[model samples]
Target: MCNARGDEAQAVARLGFLEWAFTEPGQVTAETVKDALRHPATKAPGSAAARAFVDYLRQAVTPLSAGRARRGRARALH
Candidate 1:
């Protein structure tokens, strides 16, 4: 049980690092990260990993959509 707990803690820490690393300068800006993830035009075709990074972005943005919805509701009430 202790080993499992340690593994879970390590996983959480790694995720936090990734979240910070992926964030853009001065903000948690995913668009900036997305732009950085793109391959150079000189490359004939982007790598499979680059395409996967973009797919991750699409999935990640869904939660942000709900945050926006909450903010809009707050504004409407004012």
Candidate 2:
């Protein structure tokens, strides 16, 4: 009853996951995302959409971290 589609609990959990994507704790490492994926709430019915988003989030960070690492290595060369 919390929203038009109901399943308020799942919705709240999903919102938490989304918020984690941009928060300090969530940005730690791949393990953080993995833990979120393993969370029971993430497996709820509406999760079909979360897969792509999670994948995108996972993929999006790869290059950014890599680039930073690359720059750090380059700086060391100087």
Candidate 3:
């Protein structure tokens, strides 16, 4: 029915917005991203893809202190 279709469309739009918030340069902070992940809109059944994207962002932004330390060691050797 038209109502079901409309709901699906709205869910898709919300997923797109969340994706942009997670991936776009400087659009959102890690805490904001976490909050968005917990939001009901993001938790909709149709939002699995968007949820995965935000999860990827969460892992990608994890502190890189170990990597930085290795880079510093390499630089010291140069």
Query: What lDDT does candidate 1 reach at residue 59?
Result: 52
What are the candidates' C-alpha RMSDs? 9.3, 8.3, 8.2
Q: Residue-wise lDDT of candidate 1 within 1-78, one digit each (tens)? A: 112234454554356446745664676566654554454631332444333434444454445458788899999999
lDDT of each: 0.49, 0.56, 0.60
RMSD in angstroms, candidate 2?
Answer: 8.3
Give residue 55's error in model 3 in angstroms: 1.8
* Candidate 2 wrongly placed segments (more than 4 Å): 1-19, 47-51, 54-78
List the candidates' TM-scores in order: 0.33, 0.35, 0.38
> Which RMSD does model 1 reach against the true structure?
9.3
How many angstroms is residue 42 displaced in model 2 relative to the true structure, after the best TM-score fit? 1.7
Candidate 3: tens digits of C-alpha lDDT, residues 30-62? 776676567675454444444545455456457
- What candidate 3 gets wrong by more than 4 Å, as runs, is 1-19, 22-27, 41-48, 67-72, 75-78
- Top-TM-score structure, candidate number: 3
Clash pairs for candidate 2:
none
Task: Give the alpha carbon lDDT tens digit for every residue of 1-78 in model 2.
Answer: 133233544465467556766675524577666665666644643443454445544553564548888889999998
Ordered by TM-score, highest first, the candidates read: 3, 2, 1
> Which regions of candidate 1 are displaced past 4 Å?
1-23, 29-45, 64-78
What TM-score does model 3 achieve against the real structure?
Answer: 0.38
Model 1 Cα displacement at 77 (Å)?
Answer: 33
